[model samples]
Target: MENYNVDTVLKDIFDSKDSNNWKPSDKIPLVTKEIETLKNDLKTFLKSSDYNMDAILKESQELCDETNLLVSGMEMCKQEIEEETMAEILHSIENHDRLTKELESVNFALNIVYDVVQCGKYVKEFDDGREAQSFTRAVEAVYDLLQYIEMPAEGFKQLDMYNNTRHTAQLILDSLLSDLYGEWDRLISTSVKPGNKKTTITITLNIEDSLIVIDVLNALEKSKKLVEKVMEFSQFLLKDVLVPIINNDCIVFAETDELMTITVNQKPDFKPAYDAVIANLRLLFHYLSNKLNVEYYRDNSIMKMMGKQICAEFSDILVKDCLIDTIPNNINELQSYGQITSEIEDFQHFLVIVKFFPDDKISILKYVNNIDILFASKSSQYFLETARTIMLKDLSVTMSIGVETIPEGNPGTSADVSGTEEEALKILNKTMPRSLFYFPRCMISKTAQELLDLVYVMMEQAVQCSDVVCKKLYNTTRLVFELYDAVVPYHHENYLQTIPQYVALFHNNCMYLAHNLQTFGDKWLILMEGRELDYPISFVDLVQKLRDLGYRHLAIHMQQQRKQILDNIRSSDLNCIVVKDVLSDNAEAAVRQCLRQLHLLKNVWIGVFPINVFTRLMATLVNMFVDELIHRVCTVEDISMEMATQLTDMYTLVVQKAPLLFQNTTDVEQYVKSWKKLQELIFVLGGSLKDIEKHWKDGTGPLAVHFNTEELRSLIKALFQNTQFRANLLSKIK
Candidate 1:
């Protein structure tokens, strides 16, 4: 409000020397009033007017200039202070270097302590368990040193200041950790000892050594027992537990009406024992998770694999026990199957047992497959044994047999019966009744479905299994499959060497097999439908798997039998014409034998022998019969007309036997070819050439009327077997 001269008042205040001594504090009232005025002016300018920088700069220029001069002066003072502080810091650094050298001298004195850590670097060479022993001294050395890192911040500060000490300490710790890791690697290597035949004694000497090695693994003070826990679980579970239980020689069984049960008490302490190991391992895993930078799953895999192997062994033992108890009883009951034929007392029992097999099989498979899966995942032998058990249950005869003799027991009062054939009577009487039991001549005991099931178990268990297991499975399946042929000889050396019995048994057993296979295939398909049994494609279907299982010959044999049955199975036409006994019959009896031989030749014979071979076989038998008949008739002491007439009747009957033997045109054609061979002999057997012609031309003799001299001669030359007989007959023809 005081309007003094504006420019001159401020210029005087700026230029006056007195202003230097004048404290701004003393002029606070004037400065406060001036600020009040400027603040009011700014408010007015913001409300109404455009900004004018020249006017604003003119007002604050003095204050701004003063602020810049003060800042420059303060900056110069700060630089001078900083220069002196830097010189002092350099002196402190020089002092720190001198102290570090002194500390280095102290560290030189502690070389004895560093020597323990240096022991790890020297332990590069590891001997048997001794290499790990060298690590023990190193571990003990660094055990105290590792705690240095774990010390409080202020405590660790002492080491942090001395770089050489910290570096040397770190190197010692690294060396100890490396040696400890090497020891762990050793433990892991010793955990499994495969290739031992007795897997029950699973621990190798390396594993035993692992015990001592692990005890010495007292490194990394925090995780000292971590190595032992891992090794103990991995090695001991299989060796100390699984092996003892599997290799336990104890056999325990309890029988019931329905089935034989393996005592649960016999199963080893596998789960409880494993669970305990798992509990310790879980803690070990937790501890190792912190100390080591490793995958949780990978670090524990060695133990897990061992655990699975234990499970495999446990399942196998349970299964083996189940089979050992049940199979013997099953076979004992199976032996009673012969009772269905001969012993009728247990007829209902036999029926029930046979009928229950499917259910029994399912039950057996339920456990076996579970066991098989355990091993299929880990071990090969579990699979091999499971596949092997199905047949091992009844390792006796391939055929089913009835008890024929009572050994050293009660009898039907007679010591020996007159006229009873020695062979037949021997079966009737016995010192040991069961021992005399042999397969009934042509009767088959095992159902085809049962045999097929055996094949499935043998092969399916081998699926996804190891190479060694697959080989054993293949060889065993082949061996068991051969039992079918032995029990019921489709083909055997005895059958081949003995032709007459071969023909009879071949037809009977062939039909037995054909009918049974058809039933088996139907049931097997039904059983398998909608069921996804884990099998290789070759084994998925029973029919195909049998072929792949080396039972290809048997499978093909069944197929041929099926074809022959479809062709026709004439059980009534079964020929009992014994070729060996034919020569013993009288002329008329021999004629009847010839007719019987012809009847057999005509009927369709289904067997291991194909139709072509069957036809040839029949032709040979018929030729032999006719040969015996001719020899018997011609060699008679009296060559009278009556005898000649009797020969005509025999020849006629032989020819009559051929009329309806064949059902088809092709078969008839084949029969006629064979018939022509017989006709040659018939001409010679009828009489001399003149009488033969009478018999041939005459309407009376059926064969003679049909076959003339040239035809008969051609038949003998073409198909007749005996050359001397052919010559003798042909000479008579001339």
Candidate 2:
């Protein structure tokens, strides 16, 4: 049966044709063959097997019956057991639920008891630590109590014992903080306050005591108050001690072995005062560190607290109030302050040693470092005052006038003239005008020198300041010179008018100031060029103004001199010489008087102005006299032989004496513009008509060059006969 192929044979019969094409003949053989094969396989299976079919069926029916009977019996037994135990099971479940509730209640009560007992134990430890003065231990116990009370057993917070325990811990913590702060305040007061002690401040606490306080405050996270308390103490010291010492009140500073009371005296010295301040601070730090044991607590130590407060006091109180007033006003006084800056630097180093100040936090030191600028601001007034004194010393301040040497290869002075005798004379004459002149150098009055010295000192100080402050100081320096320009002209106007020497000195001073200031601003700018400047630095405008001022003074004085010279000529009555038979002594006396005035001016202006300017001025005055003399002579309508001779002699006297005005440096004609014209007029006045014609040379000679045709015609009509020859000569003069 297991090896039978019945399905394969049947499928072969069916699949031999399509279903629609099925026929008995096509399928009968395949079906019959499969049927025969099935029959054979069945017979073989039956013959080879050894089994009893009836017996096997009987055994299966017996097992099925037994299974049904067992199931019925089990169901009946389960129903009986359920009916008997149902009420007892429900009762036991109720009992178990009630007992569990009772057990939970008991455990909750035990937890409450444990939490309250633990809180009470910690409170007792906190109280014990407090009684023993062990603040760290007390704060630690309170810390534990606070931790436990944060989340106690459920419903434990509503209990009276729980809240009472937490409240007790809180009270202890507050008390500890208050006591610790009190101890800190005491430490500060004792360390900083001098009280009535004349010398060393006594420290009542040991190092262990100070450390105990520091540890307690830090444990409670309240060290920030330390800095606040220190600043308050610093203010107290500033008001009571520092203020008196700086203000030069009855309280003064004196050195002692330790913290000492300020000595009572009227005298105040900044050095000793500052030294006393530093000494007190040193003793304070020394006592606090050595005796109080605060050095061990580096973060919140007393030294650090006081160091920060002292740094602020240095800028706000010491620098602003006390040290600022100590700044010197003058250069001599400034010597006293040389070590003050160093002392401040030493104070900075001391701060560094104490490790209280950080390198990045130097704002207070910056204020102290600006001491130079402070000095400049204060001393600028001194600079101005000194300059004022020098300028106002006297109207007639003098210095021995010395000739400054001319550099080689520079333009020649009158002394350098060299040519033919006449050519050299002409060259010397050309050098006389002040308009085209050279000065080797001009001398300054003693007042001017003193002012310049002050200026140099001020500019040097200005260069040492910051750019903004330096500019201010330099502007102050400009004001100094401006003061001179203003003060001299105003205060000494009378002296300038009456005294030639004073006028000369004022002019030279003005020139000297102008000369130095020309490059003054630029020179300092170069020295101070490390910073960028916003505007140009130059005194070009000021130099021009000073020059104008000098010229104005000199011109005003020259006006008076001109009037005197012209008035002397008028007094001579030179018109009488043209018509009088005898020459008047008044003419000679007038020349002498004019020479006296010229000599006086020459004496004052000789060393003051350059040689050329002095000579030019003198020649200009002489030329004015010549102009007046000629005008007087021309006014005469006719002249006798004696009159012409007298006029000629007067001309000779002037020509011979006028050269003295130049100090013999040049000839008179060289500087005097109309000198030759005067000579030609004199020649024509004294000569005959033939001689005059020869001198005139038909309008091209000296006479024609000196006088116009009309002037020559007038002269000929007055001194010679109005004949056909004279008329012809005057016509020919053109």
Candidate 3:
């Protein structure tokens, strides 16, 4: 019965148009042949298989006709049933509508009765619970009854019974509130007993029963009253216990008998009393929060009020009494006070944790935090005074030889023992050598070292202080150094001039002070590491000031030495010296005196200053000497060969002796800038005009490098005749 259209099937199969090669028209003949073959096969199969095709079709038609007849008959039956039941259905709907209205009315009246009965039950339960002193349960019943009658159903609102019920519930709530208050009043009491030296608190409270009272008060919506009552109790405790403990000097709670022996060596310390006060305050907090369960009284906020009161009272005690006594007298005492302040801060943190004190509102350690202000003022005065005392007491310089022990592994390093192991027998045994040896230290004075030690102490205190107080302490640091800065030079003005040892020691002291002060700000910078400062303190400027102070004093001495040598040279009249008299010329004596003075300074400076600094100072002296000689010779109008010979001899003597000042170091020429130029000028003055031109090297030589054109011109005019060669050299020097 499932027939296929062979022509269409064959057309679809053979009509495959391959986009690569074949088109629909090209496969038409094959499609026609296949359709014919399929049709023939279908006909042959039908003819060979059966002959009942028409009869089957007729049977299917008959079944369709029978289904149609059944469907039509059922429709007729449905219409007949609907006609028969329509009137009864309408009547049932009418009865349902009428009963639903009556049901709604009855349910409404029943809900009202039920609600009223529930109210009455709760009221009765409240009355019974109140009688039984079950305040939690009684309060719960009153709360429920009040809620029920206060907000009745919308339909019941207009009824007189509901209005009366609301009134009765209000009265019941008032009575419940009154009973809760009465119970609370009976649960706790406080009595303060003031004594001669202390005050005692007598607190009576039912810890277990107070919890019940708190719960009843909370349930009755009277928690504010509970908070108020708790605050009142805390105030009494603060007044009677906290204040008295902090005020009394005795640490122990029990009164001590006068007959109790005191330790004579023991000093009176407030720490024990402070510890006891803190411990008692902690116990008070525990008693309120953990024992009485006051945290639950107002959602953990009941203690905040108490905390505020404690904050006020404790803060007052610290500021007005305790901190006033804690004024530190010295650094060690200040350190102790710092520790106490730290403990006070920790106590404040504890209050924040347990008593619900606000961190920002904590003022108990306010004065403690800023107490460094007072301490800084006192410290500044103390440092200034102590520095003045130290500076004034020992104005004399006590020179300490700077030494370091040779490392043990080094060869030939040994110790010198003057006294024998049997020194008890007064034996004097001496060793050949000593491992400990002296070296240069830009040596600081004893007073300077003491001042530095004081600065170190102040620095530590500043580092330990709070930022606000640290700033003030920095001023103290500045004041201490400023005092030294002003006082050191003024104190030793006379010695600095006459005493070479004093000058050297003073120079070393200034160098040491400046060197130590170089990192002075760095130590204080530890405070600003994690914090930003608007105006950061630095010792850079102060360090420069100290250096300048040292240089200023050194310059004063150098200028004095300079004036002495220059005066000696001026008085010798080298410009008018005899050409042939070379044995004992005034210039030679001046030169000798200059060298002698330099040698004396060298002796004082050796082993006192580091080699480089020694070389620098000696070279400076040599330069001054050579420069004055050059100035004298350059002023001479005509230098005969004999005068040049005398000047050359003086120059050679200076050169030979000046180098001995830097004996082991590099050379005098390396440190002294004008040394080579002075030699070149002396050569040019003594040599013929050719020697001058050759040394000049057509303006590209050492002569041209050291002496300016005007200097060489002046020298040429003073020493040489006005020849064209000199004029041309002068013109080329430009």
Cα-based TM-score, every candidate: 0.30, 0.49, 0.42
Alpha-carbon RMSD, each predicted model: 22.9, 12.7, 18.1
Q: What is the lDDT of residue 569 in candidate 3?
A: 78
- What are the per-model numbers of colliding residue pairs? 3, 1, 0
- Check candidate 2 and list the clashing pairs: 429-670
Would you give me the overall lDDT of model 2? Answer: 0.69
Among all windows of 10 consecutive residues in model 2, the one with the lowest summed lDDT is 197-206
Candidates in descending TM-score order: 2, 3, 1
The C-alpha stretches of model 2 lying farther than 4 A from their native spots are 1-325, 329-374, 394-406, 409-442, 575-584, 640-642
Q: Write the per-residue lDDT of candidate 1 for residues 432-510, one digit (tens) a residue.
A: 4442223223223233335545556645554434444444554555444455444434324343333433333334334
The lDDT-based order of candidates, best leading, equals 2, 3, 1
lDDT of 1 at 19: 75
Say which candidate scores most in TM-score: 2
lDDT of 2 at 46: 69
